[model samples]
Target: MSDIPQERRVLTAIPGPKSVELQARRTAAVAAGVGSTLPVFTARAGGGIIEDVDGNRLIDFGSGIAVTSVGASAEAVVRRASAQLADFTHTCFMVTPYEGYVEVCERLAELTPGDHAKKSALFNSGAEAVENAVKIARAYTKRTAVVVFDHGYHGRTNLTMALTAKNMPYKQGFGPFAPEVYRVPVAYGYRWPTGPENAGAEASAQAIDEITKQIGAENVAAIIIEPVLGEGGFIEPAKGFLPAIARFAKDNGIVFVADEIQSGFCRTGQWFACEDEGIVPDLITTAKGIAGGLPLSAVTGRAEIMDAAHSGGLGGTYGGNPVACAGALGAIETMRELDLNARARRIEEVMKGRLEEMRAKLPNGAVIGDVRGRGAMIAIELVKPGTKDPDAAATAALAKACHAEGLLVLTCGTYGNVLRFLPPLVIGEDLLNEGLDILERAFATL
Candidate 1:
């Protein structure tokens, strides 16, 4: 068990005096663009709670943006990483390779979806892994066009910014983006004009038509998408959507890449969301929860496709840091030992049930435009009562209310109208319900 208590406790105001001082110092030192959901600073965190400088124990619903699935300081991860740290922090895998890096790649090969011969290369962040995936795909297919979907967010890098769809915060004033990256419509069930039943096939058909017509299928190198959209509001693409896209990619020799950065590991009640549909992609990019809060990412794919790049063609100085690799191994071990996949499903059952009940109790059900997502990765789209139009203000207000009461929540979406929930997998049932109770109170305030 963790030393930190699994309960919400507020001391002083959220930022308190100490945190206020630190925020002042941060303002002077940090750039303006760097923003935080809370003004308070984290002193320590473990299990389901984050203790701030004020000694305010906030329930962690954000999981540091889905980066710490096993908890912020999981015992196994801390133990393994500490041992590796004492021995050596970094020998630079490119200069002098290490067993830890090789072992992590081997694990990725085994864990990532697919039984085919596979290979993997590591990177320090999801964006880097994505950039490398595109590189490998182009090298293998000998083509340049890359297809991405509407409302998907890959990363902040120049190349990924082109792949992303949202404009205001992610893409405004950040162009000209990488070329030949085409955007297609994804299966958004709630907003589907023709209805959710037809969303899968119709969205896939529309995407395929756009790719084949605008960017010739033969010219396309890869079609990269998130099986469950992340920063684009936890939208699970409609059923049959992934399979149709995968079939098109296979037939046209275009590499299919699943960006499972946010939805991978046990966050989505599966090791990888792609497994839900059994749609194996030619390449998959992983990060976030892979290293138990450590910065590490990987591009795992078929042997032939991965090996397409020439020897010495792919690598980075800190691609697979030894300590990060140890942390990843520990995370995988913990997942198996605790069966986090099962825990995630239980969380889904409990939380979704409560959320649905909350919706039913509301005077006007349209306050929650949609409640969707799988397992621990759930979200609610807020809207004006009795209307489908987005209520971004209500979303912001609800998140603010949660934060004020020692419940840390996060908001996201293409239109800034989603309140995403990404609690650590190890959160206890009672604590989880208490957090939901706090959320219901926040909703009531709204």
Candidate 2:
């Protein structure tokens, strides 16, 4: 498979024959409320490309929303998963415990940042991990309020929706959110009202101060944040801001939770983004790429904090599915043996080089307002030239053009004006360059 030629061949138009048939069937059989990114239907996928039902090969930069860090159809991942399935499919960890589940938890203890004794509980999705984290925080701190930053996306569940910032799609008619949830401004340098050039410390300090004043730090159970904002435009918090928040949370007895669902597992160069600042979060939530596309999420934290919840309160029927545990174990081994953290840095080097070049050339390029993110988790925010106003229309146009040209990309942001790149860390340089070229051409059209 490695020797197979890597080429993009459009045998038919994007929604060609089979895809049109499927789309028609989908309209009838699937929910009318379903949303789609591209009309193209996927038939197969390998290293860095997804083959549509029309047989069109397109470079993939979304990675199933960053759940396949080792690439779709990874050899080791497939092998391990296949072996696990051969042994047994499900015993329901709660009903019958397994060694693989325990092994995966042990690995989490070792890998997740912190030298302190840690404990972990697995779940089926990032939201579950987040919800569990909240439960643990409440139990430990005996507080009711959970504070989240603006533009932060925790999940779509009732409690998480309250924690999430976006209103339109996520929380539009789903109102009357969970109680005791407080919102604060994030350190988004691009549109920060205070100004971008200044150190974000002032804005962060102000946010902390306001939260403390309004809710009283003692009443806060936890302060959850994504180290590099995920759906919030992949914005990395400014220097000193994260550390300051960490210190504040510690001093106030607030559980500092780092939601690394989209930034973990070498996606941000470091195993975890908080490691960049050397800040130790009281609890860390992980999912997405953790189990190589299998559904698994975990909350790892200080043993004492984790122990706050009763044993019966934590376990879920399918929390640590054995197959997912096996897949996670294999995924971790693959990352270690293949050195995907270093690979992520290499990808950043290639992508940054191309993006910086694009930034330098185009005049309308002010659409590329900011290019930031650590390692393979990168994004470019689109904006009206010389202003912080979001160019959401331009972002949609660029994404449409790229899709038409056989390149898959994803857009994210509070304003829906940013293009985020989450290609598998194993993507080849040639494929990466090809995707970048497609993006360049798309920008040219814009």
Candidate 3:
């Protein structure tokens, strides 16, 4: 583990001299479109703390956007990756097969939901895994139309961009997206007009109605959704919503894909978010928390659906890099040893309790319109004082306040009015509490 103390220590201002200088350098070298939430550069991180170049240690609530559930540089992951690096770097899996890749696929098969003889294929990132899943679905169903939800986020690839609903940032200038993609409503409980109790059935009915009237289920290749939406906000679909859509897909011969990229690997208390409602998707796309901090993603699903692709039809040069596979194995070892699934449930108890308390303490018509999500993937949606309209500016200001106070936070949602918390599952309770304190202080400022 990193030697940095498990406490928020600010030796200087949040973006001190060193970080400011790096920000200036980055401005010249990096593209403006490739934005960053914080300007400070990290020197080291571990156990819920990220030490910046200025030596200021801030409490990490983002976990590198859910990429480091086992800590930024976990011991097991580092050890395995180092050994693999020393042995041999790469001889692409396709050109020369390797055992590490096979082992990783085996693990994925065992880990992902379902017991009907599952199979898996590894990739370098979540987007690639999702793209490949789409290919397999289309091939198996012999259909072309793909259905997505209103606030769901898949990835940035051309195909995923079409799957994702956000346009301002992800799909603004990247037009001419892939064809045969359809968008429908999601049961975002808090935002539903007819209250959360009925949101599930209402949204499902509308979605099915739309599909039947327009795309028609017979032509739909797949129905993809995030059990807990990520960049579009930590929006958990209303209860019964996912199951209804899933049943519709199955009945219509449409492949059901759960984008578990952000909510998988114990982030949602369960192994995957879909398991919360006993949803057994035909294909599940995973990444982010899969290989510690390394680049790795997998598409795990039923053997028949996974094997639909022709032998030479799917793969990439660096899809299942040996080093990443080792890291994944090590990550799995750490998860098993630490019982991170239980840890995530504990996280929910602490975080949800604190956030709900905060919401209650605040007066009626406060900026926080809603507090929602599962496990560590929680969020607070900011809204106008008297109405349910999104308060994006207040959300940004609160996040900036948190950043300055040594509590690293992130904002999401289609309207950019959600403050999301994705702390590493291994984060200590004391430190997590302290970060929440700073968050409370930030909200007070708003």
Candidate 4:
């Protein structure tokens, strides 16, 4: 559907002459804090390929960090957004409310898990949605403390940075974060101290005990978690772990918030990863793939809980902008028409199967500790061959190798030892296989 060709091509080196010039200009103009993975400078992107300024067509495995699940140039999204732009782009929802905003909230209430009465409020980013979710929970329960999991990644904002567990890149020098936030253990199957099999029961019990003894559940407003931790290595909390936590939250009258920002919108073969265990949360935050690359995030939850926020208490100047709402409506249409959920499942089958095979054939001293994740959000954790110690250097090397061959890949994890793959769901099967072939070759040389 896009004008650009879908195949990968390389006319020059990965960062060719033109990109070198742009990189210099970028270095001078852009702030030092902004970082990029493969910064060749994109000219155009569609389906599975990103044509760089150097005329090299790199296979896109990152999908702009899983924001373009429906393809960056999806037809429906473009048409709807263009129409909305022609009509009007501004006039904030609080000032002049639009039908688009109401429609988007309606759609969210219908799509999100659980048949109970639901309500939603839109925001400009995942962090805003998360912050609002916490606000609503605290206001409703009159509690102050919030609970997060180990290795969880919420956002870069002050409160979210406090929620996040990793220190190096995300936290480091940035501190003086919001208080009353507590971190507990997550059921990371591969790195569980006791063992993978005991991770579900033991970790859940430990987290619950800590919450009860340390924070006192009565004072906790919410317990938020990513059903599939994203930046934390695509770590899928061990089976039974999510349900157990959800149960505890319900029992203690605490709001269970599922931070589905990276794992929602069919990224994990379900509308939200919480659905995998049939664990419905009192509040769910979503973003990334919601609007076919347009910036839009939401906090959808029980009607009673959501209404707790005073009408004037929740909103942003740019929250649920009409054009973004139009893009979200079109994105929802595309998802239903294409059944992207099933597409994600098929991708999981093909990718996970290939990864398992590659792992089986690794050399005597190769390091690939675990292959995990579901649907389009797969990752491989790099370790020190026989031991479970993380090998961040190996992960960096593999990503660089793939980039050199014009295959855009990304690395993530608290320890920086995960190689994550998030190809667009609309990518052609041939392109998917070709990207995998490039990865396979990278692994072979490693």
Candidate 5:
């Protein structure tokens, strides 16, 4: 049980006075590139409530962008991390190998979807994990090209920016990205050119054809995709799409990499979303929910492929920091103890049911567009009232409305029309409902 109360309470305006002052300070101190969903500065957070500087307790539906699955201040995570911190903070794993790092790698080997002699290497962020995965794939396959899908967002680094599909915010001015990266259409059911029903087969065929034509399959090192698209609107690729791509990769000797950074660790009703399709990737990248809010990421894969790198080829100074590893161990324990996988499923049922009901009853159902995603990683795509055209304006308005009412919601999408919901798995049923109620009211206001 957390010390903070599990409820939403607004004592002042959204930003309040203290948060306004903090925002001013942040504006001067923080870089201009940095951004936040809500202007309210968080004082503390635990369970499903985020207490801001103004004493406003907001229902946290974003979960710090799906980074805190076991809640922000999970007891075990704090306890274990504190224990590790008291002993020693940094002895860089690359310099003096630590037990915590090895233990975390062991956990990754066991938890990631694979049974064939798995191994892992830890990194500091999702981008590092992804870049390392690419490196490993290239080393093993002795190939240069990597294939990514439409609307897929890998990371912000040069290589990952080349892999990502979105252009405005992620890759607007940043240029001269890494080379040998090819993009293909994803099975985005909502806007699939052919149609949603045919998206699975058509998109698969089209992607393969493009790869074969543009970049010879023989020269491709990897085909990486998010089983459930993250910043690309939480779009779960159409059924059979993953299996088809995985099969193609296996047949062509291309490393099939699952970028589970935002969808792994019980966020999508499974440890990894690839498990939903029973598709095992050669390499899987994970982060966000792994370390109970700590910055940690990993590339877990088959031992043979992982060992393709030279003895001293892969490593970083802060990869798998001791405290972060301890937090990850604690987070895994908390997940097992609480059975958060089942909890995530329950959240899905409750959220999907409520969202569906709301969609049916909302004055302009078409404006709500599509409601999709698995488990707690759900999203609703806003569209024009009478057409399938994206309604980014409505999406922004709705998110702002939610924020004003002390509910934290996030908007995403290549077109910026998705409202994503990612509440902590430990969120009380009442708080979940209350948050959804706020979202419904926000929709009504729109």
Candidate 6:
């Protein structure tokens, strides 16, 4: 363990020998439908770096799309998972049940925001969590209509794709989507028709009014939103937006669901981004980093709403596998012991400071149109200067340059022009700075 190298050392060009050879094999053996962010295949990862199969180490800003918050290969996680593997691997929660599954639910009830009595159901991915939340909402309210916002991404499932607003990749050729799902304008400040200068309160009010007028609140079962829009350029709704939506949902008897699949578990400075405004959502969907790297997703909500579903109405064959439960237990313990929430804030401090400097220095030349997001879940929207048009070319160029220099980053957004950063909170300051420096240089060259 002590012999592991701490810094990145690029021995060969990114794809190198092994990765290139593997890529060719993968293209032949694997599905071409699958896409890759980086051509280099990973050999190992720890702290903030990923070593490719070619022996080239690169600084990782994308934590497996925010799945390794505690860092790739956390010591406690490894030990706990290994021990659990020796004890038992599977015994479906619904069929045989297990203590680890119950314990995970208990932890989720205790951790998720809200003092109300809560219950949880585990699943396999963020998409399943989302679908279950909708199912629970419909059962509880006995309503057919579900409300979502523009730019929101639920998942790739049939129902979630209907809820998701993007086309081409997520929704195109996949529809006709599930029925009774309605979409309203999101309070996206940058591209908002009213513009960024407008108060968030006004935009949210208008959105609420429009939705109520179109669908009539009485017909709605729930209103789902991401506290911080993930694939939507990390857009943080205007200040009063979330709180206003919460209030409206409460008054209309609509189930307020916060999709924290990407923003939960200290990814945002707080345990959940909804806590930023002291809003307690009726239902919360989570996954991604919930069980370290293991597959586990959950829907935790008010006890009554969760219980509305009849016995056996919810669950899956591998919903709460014992091994995943163990991993979740360890992941939660690691988070609490390490104070990762504070670490997220620390990451934000460093990131915001550097990004602001970048914004100032390259005001005109820099393609970064806007920088926003809370805690470690940060993103910079790229656009042509003096216009809101997306600068996809510039964004692509920057990402490629960074990868060539031994850095891993990701691009997202409805227009595919926003560069998102989801570095593991456990990443050392030196490594984090190195990745940032590479990004700065890439922007300068652009």
Candidate 2 lDDT, tens digit per residue, 361-427? 9978777889888889999999898887899999999999888888889999999999999998888
Candidate 4, 1-446: lDDT as tens digits = 47888888888888889998999999999998999887799888888888888889989999999999998888999999999999999899999899999999999999999999999999999999999999999999999999999999999999999998999788999999999999999999998988889999999999999999999999999999999999999999999899999999999999999999999999999888999999989999999999988999999999999999997999999999899999999989999999999999999999998888888886833588899999999999999888989999989998999999889999999999999999999888888888889888888888
The per-model lDDT (C-alpha) reads 0.93, 0.89, 0.91, 0.93, 0.94, 0.89
Winning model by lDDT: 5
Candidate 1's residue-wise lDDT over 1-446, tens digit each?
35987878998887789999999999999999888989989989999999998899999999999998999999999999999999999999889999999999899889988899999999999999999999999999999999999989999999999999999888899799998899999999999999889999999999999998888999999999999999999999999999999999999999999999999999999999999999898999999999999999999999999999998889999999999999999999999999999999999999899999999997755699889999999999998887789999999998988888888999999989999999999998988999999999988877
* Per-candidate count of clashing residue pairs (backbone under 3 Å): 0, 0, 0, 0, 0, 0
TM-score result, candidate 2: 0.97
What is candidate 3's lDDT per residue for 300-372, written digit by digit as tens?
Answer: 9999999999997989999899999999999999999999999999998999899888888966427778888
TM-scores for all predictions: 0.99, 0.97, 0.98, 0.99, 0.99, 0.98
Residue 2 of model 3 has an lDDT of 64
Which runs of model 5 end up more than 4 angstroms from their true locations?
none
Rank by lDDT, descending?
5, 1, 4, 3, 6, 2
Write down the lDDT that model 3 would get. 0.91
Report the C-alpha displacement of residue 54, candidate 5, in angstroms.
1.0
- Residue pairs with backbone atoms closer than 3 Å in model 5 (clashes): none
Once superposed on the true structure, which residue ranges of model 6 sit more than 4 Å away at CA? 1-4, 197-199, 363-366
Tens-place lDDT per residue, model 6, 268-306, is: 988899999888999999998888889999999999999
- List model 5 lDDT by residue over 145-169, tens digit each: 9999999999999999999999989
Error of 6 at 382 (Å): 1.0
Model 5 residue 302 lDDT score: 98
**Local error of candidate 3 at 110, Å?**
1.0
Error at 261, model 5, angstroms = 0.4
